[model samples]
Target chain A: MASATELRRTPLTALHEDAGARLVDFAGFAMPVQYEGILEEVGRVRTVGGLFDLCHMGRVRILGERREEAAQFLVHPNISKLKFGAIRYSFFCREDGTTMDDVLVYRDTDEVFFCINAGNRDRDIAWMREVVARYDCELQDLSDDLAMIALQGRASVDALAPLCTGEPPEPVRREGATGPAALKYYSFMRGSVCGHEAMISRTGYTGEDGYELYFAADKAPEIWNALLETGKSAGLTPIGLAARDTLRLEAGMALYGHELDDTTNPVEAGLLPKMVKHTHDFSGRAALEAAIAAGPQRRLVGFTTAGKRVPRQGYTLHLPGDDGGAAIGTVCSGSPSPTLDTIIGTGYVRSELAEAGRTLAMDIRGKRQDVTLVEMPFFKRDY
Target chain B: MSNPTDLKYTASHEWARLEGDIATLGITAHAAESLSDLVYIDLPAVGDSITAGEAFGEIESVKAVSDLKSPVTGEVTQVNSGLEDNLSVINSEPFGGGWMIKVKVSGDLPADLLDAAAYDELAAADAH
Candidate 1:
């Protein structure tokens, strides 16, 4: 019910408007949807370089006497699989197995840095505090004091290499922050970026090769301008949330409200393997186990439309037939893929009909149109 | 976001051109500007009957999808099929190459349509 003006503004809000971006409210914060065009930004991120302002997301630091033990209460049981200085994608779930929110966990020696969805920040913070009360760990919300920017694409490595002036530590290299760019994927290092203290991580939701730079909130505008100027020659373009959705969908990544929600469990969402078998017995483990054992009655899958007409969310998916058509599922997220040059979407289909290559149809304005279940991700990089 | 003086405008942002018994229709430049960066368009087929104030087509930009309503009652005689390949022309040349369809007048055109100045007044009021 809130207007874009009522949403919180990031430190770089002025900069975005100055660049002629179309701003809209997203997750309770005014955010840019695109500077020029979604198609162009999508193409640029896949090929060259792209920048995204992700300042609206919530950032929290967890540290204390029993940080390791407390993590099981804070995140998924898969926290054990994440190495120090690395980032792992996971979900924060309720005891009923419904998702509270999805988040990215960054492991440090004595603490975990958590990046949560912007809209759920207040609720997530309160829940984490209540859940971790028994433990010695403390949860600190850092959202108001930090700004995050993502530099993504194949050329992002070389573009960020110049910022790391010193011989980067091995931990930094492992998390995709090495200056020479030998760091593996999903890694990060805390160091100086353009003379500002920053955490540069090799992680992005766009499914492209990229880095995320987190810095002090006050330094956001200067750092954003600096990155634009420095990376201008490398064909780096400022991307908006519209392009962000298309890029993630093409990569088969999940969005919070669309693919994963309060009623959607990780197993049914097709993320069962990463459930991390009771490693420390985290919350929602029992329900997740039961769901996994019951074999997830509904499954999320990808489909490509036969025509340019995009299948929007809530559109009923039907199985084609000569006599009375039967409803099979519903589209959760759908859009015209700017990169693929056609329509693509994700849907929850009955488990029996979730196989790749299965034929499906979507009721587009009362007319049933043919669609095909395809292998996710809808796209992939060569190397 | 130009509202050409020669064209009559609808409050819904459509523009009408009445030439003899033919009415050429397209979205105004202001409409295209408000719906920045066109992505897809579903143009009405020729021979489809359209009534004034009724939806005749659909247009989608990156962030949202909007309906294109008819400003005059008529039977569609032609559609700008070129939009099937290039929708951005709506942003570049909305009045000319981006015209949506041409219709043969059936009944009387809507009398409530506004000229350029009147339409501009409506636009300004909406802005406030």
Candidate 2:
């Protein structure tokens, strides 16, 4: 294990340490894996609210008249008609029909902002740079310049709405905008929040009504501290990666290194439905088309088992009961849900076994336990 | 409250209190706090023999799963039945209600068994 100095530290590193967080080396950066505790943090986010430091995620800008065209060709989503001041979830794929990195394209006023995963930050930038020669555009890595904070849960808007300066776009209005109106989901506004310039967007991985705020890295402590103080009445606590993983897993959202990888295609990972189905010469378009025509051999499915048994990664999935020996799939992400009181997991299996009612089995270490395939999103908020 | 001076600790963080041939086994509070938010513990069954410095059980929390090594060779005389429903007690009362296994010792304790002061030094070093 490397010492703290050996790993990259975010601007908010001091704040996390001051809060007594359990910091761990994650994706080359020293990040808090849990603060307070996973169960307590997860419960708070599901019921009341929580804030997350997402500075480790990559931030970059693509600028040019043909920026939109160049950006659209790089990812799965067709961003040609993406309105300015909007965001799109996309995947930058390799020419071999494999995933490179999943990204979020922010249609900023002057440039297209790319939010890439920390693990794939450099690779995504280099690949985009390599492909930009085909079009007219310039790519700039802006990771060191910005920091991101995610405010999540049912009560988040009630606490943060007053801080945003500009009137949130219609339908997603705040109490100040009118009353009872929240930032329309997935919409964003450029304004001053907590006395700091911010781009607040109603986007989150927790599957809750929430917002993600982006601001200057140097001002991270001020913004983070302000959110905590302002949100105290709304029950906002600082959550860490452990709860973040469980929250995203329960939402059926795929993580970069887990559900999707270099060897996997979006079609098999339950992302093709969100992809642009039309045939264009996008990278891996032909291979993805070929894979589509041949039919996906495997598809991602969510499952749960009885008792406290959790399905873990690399665990082989088999037919129900102990005698069922052949492997069907492998677990990608799993957690014992704090809200649901059951062990839930998601994995990819033969397309034939993707049905919701079928019973599968997981070889836990050496013991086989019954796992019933269920609908995606193991959790749903009452709010 | 974290490390009782009366108990002896192992480098793996298990604490032992020997009363003649019987030794009560539990993890130190330092170990419990380090594990944090324990979700499950797989303990040895009654009558299972444990070897000193060898793993007798495994404890799991949200972030990791770690082995619980036995400090003294012994036969498991009793096991805590309470952790099945509430494993969080290990973090709350690691020295008291969280006692994991009671054993009947077959041999002497390990020579490297640490007193509370010695274990504190180890934990203190880890803090930095």
What local lDDT score does residue A369 receive in model 1, on the 0 to 100 scale? 76
The TM-score values for the models, in the order shown, are 0.93, 0.93
Writing each residue's lDDT as its tens digit, candidate 2 over A141-232 gives 87889999899998777777666676555534545444213456666667777778888887899988888888899988988888888889
- For each candidate, the DockQ is 0.40, 0.47
State which docking tier applies to candidate 1: acceptable
lDDT of each: 0.82, 0.83
Per-prediction fnat: 0.25, 0.29
Candidate 1's displacement at residue B11, Å, is 3.2
Candidate 1 residue-wise lDDT, A1-383, digit = tens: 36556778999888888898878878878899888877788888888888899999999988887776777776774565666777888888887788988888888877888899988899999998876677867888899898899988888877777765433346546453436376567877777777888877778988888888888999988877777777789888789988899899999998989899988988888876445556587778888888977798889999998776777788788887622476779888877787787789999999999999998888876767788999999988877
> Which residue pairs collide in model 1, if any?
A175-A187, A175-A188
Screening candidate 2 with a backbone cut-off below 3 angstroms (N, C-alpha, C), the clashing residue pairs are A172-A182, A172-A183, A172-A184
Interface RMSD of each: 3.2, 1.9
Query: Where is model 2 more than 4 Å wrong at Cα?
Result: A168-183, A274-280, A322-324, B111-115
Total backbone collisions for each predicted model: 2, 3
